[model samples]
Target: MSLRDRLFGRERRSAQTARKRLQLVLIHDRAGLSPGTLDALKDDLVAAISRHVDIDASGVHVTLRSDRDKQRLVADIPLAPSRERRRELG
Candidate 1:
């Protein structure tokens, strides 16, 4: 380790962990929901989406991220091809 790492190791403060933990707190506060609530909502969304569409559930990424002036619920869902697409190609 370098001089900086040695000096910081005395107290063992991890900047990355602190930043990520604070971010999680802020996201839940801004969204007015706990992390568990967010997880429940995500599950509901996945179920609803899967009922009518084909998607890669494991590839979904959901988070509460900040926008310009407000917090937003962001989701990245990977969808499989639909019948309409196959028809168009045929």
Candidate 2:
């Protein structure tokens, strides 16, 4: 069968691939970071930030954010603030 027919037959795979590619392309365009570059940046970011603050390194999220004409590297790095956890402190 053709590519279109195959994709239609397997909806979940098609949808997953589309979503993954869309996110990848959008992040690349927004932050001018390719997949390889983004990986390197993520490694560096985790290492650099660890020097100052204690982070939930495993749960840290780094992504490109865009609003209007502005683009920024949004790092949702979860960290314990000195003593209490976020749910308790906030």
Candidate 3:
């Protein structure tokens, strides 16, 4: 390889590394949730839902989602459908 190509490659690597680090920091700042806290939250949410109905804990999905300027926590909690729900339109 040429000297110019090697220098360009180093620059690209540095840029990618910096972007990744920035994203990690920004995620924590925006959500105010540390890694440990998120884990505990997931556990608590699952327990709460399990108390009321039958759910597949393994299928539970929780994550932080962001709009252009707004951030929200989204959880998809799946529950078993009852026969009554199938018959009712209201």
Candidate 4:
């Protein structure tokens, strides 16, 4: 790592991902949910949504957001472009 990377923490993407995962685990534990529960939920959501719409499953994100006194589940699902849209862009 260069001095700039060291100074700016630019090479910490994997560390950041790990930290986020740990935070999710802590949140899940506090919420009385098993660590695997969120993964299962994400899978279920992808399946249900895929039945009705084309989605980029790989890009789907399902996470729990915790604020001061509230916690909320957030899902960011990316939809695939329709054939017409793809053709237009092409």
The whole-model lDDT of each prediction reads 0.84, 0.78, 0.78, 0.87
lDDT of candidate 2 at residue 22, scale 0 to 100: 91
Candidate 2 residue spans exceeding 4 A from truth: 1-27, 80-90
lDDT for 49 in candidate 3 is 86
Per-residue lDDT of candidate 4, residues 1-90 (tens digit): 789998998787677889988987877777766748888999999999999999999999988777876777889999998988999999
Report the Cα lDDT for candidate 2.
0.78
| 1 against 2, candidate with superior TM-score | 1
Candidate 1, residues 2-57: lDDT per residue as tens digits? 77778777544578679989987988897898878888988888899999989888
* Most accurate candidate by lDDT: 4
- Worst window of 10 by summed lDDT in candidate 4: 26-35
* Better-scoring candidate (TM-score), 2 or 3: 3
* Per-candidate count of clashing residue pairs (backbone under 3 Å): 0, 0, 0, 0
Instruction: Give the lowest summed-lDDT range of ten residues in model 1.
Output: 8-17
Candidate 3 accuracy as lDDT: 0.78
The TM-score measured for candidate 4 stands at 0.70
What C-alpha lDDT, on a 0 to 100 scale, does residue 26 get in candidate 1?
Answer: 88
Instruction: Give the distance in Å from residue 36's predicted Cα in candidate 3 to where it truly belongs.
Output: 1.6
| RMSD vs true structure, all candidates | 4.6, 5.4, 6.3, 4.7
